[model samples]
Target: MTNQGFPRGLRILTAGEYRHVFEHASFRIHGKGLLALATPNDLGHVRVGLVFSKKNVRRAVDRNRLKRLTRESVRLRQQWLPSVDIVVLSRKGVHEIDSETLARQLHGMWRRLEKDVKRQPEHQQ
Candidate 1:
């Protein structure tokens, strides 16, 4: 898993890591059917976590599809992203959208998250 892919190192692997982002996120970038909460991290690269509930996506297949779409989007955009931890939450209607649209939405959220986080004061960074 190089920097070019979604390596283990780039994932928010533990409950505590996810908790920190949820508790202290400085930027909340919302997209259609998605919400991304992000905060600066001490690590020198971006990390991501997904929260696609079965209650929202309804089926295991749909949930897996959403996760795949999100991970693929994150993997493709990770290089230029600022060092931060992000938790992405999915809404009920996510399964209705096509993969391309969902990917575009996720990409836009990442771009916005990158811009907003970089613009924050040094303390937040």
Candidate 2:
């Protein structure tokens, strides 16, 4: 899947999508941030979106930095992740972390998400 820049496309925007992420998806937290994901039924490719609010990170620069870091992290790990629409929300600590640290944390989070998905029972036809 290609990297659909964070806010440009039809992503998890509504309350319903957010609720689905919170209720149905499995999550994993890391030092840099938290990743919440749900695998879509379609057997296509993966797509990702980032949620770095100005409220959480006051400065525009900081928000953009965090989004860039998250996008890069997701791009690098895209191959391993399942075909799903993943939404990544940044925590306060993400602003305090460096890019390298963020990358590491993201890698760990990705692995955990994958494990969580694997543990779920496969669908029966």
Clashes of each: 0, 0
lDDT of 2 at 15: 69
**Model 2 lDDT per residue over 1-125, tens place:** 55534343334557676666566564444444554555453545556666777767778898888777777776666667766667787666568777787777778777876776677666720
Query: Lowest summed lDDT over 10 consecutive residues: which window, candidate 1?
Result: 1-10
- CA RMSD (A), model 2: 3.8
lDDT of 1 by residue, 18-97 (tens): 99999998899988888999888888898999999988889898889999989888888788788989899998798899
Q: For residue 37, what is the lDDT in candidate 1?
A: 93
> Which sections of candidate 2 miss by over 4 Å?
1-23, 28-31, 39-43
The global Cα lDDT (0 to 1) of model 2 is: 0.65
**Candidate 1: global Cα-lDDT?**
0.88
Q: For each candidate, what TM-score against the reference?
A: 0.94, 0.73
State the TM-score for model 1.
0.94
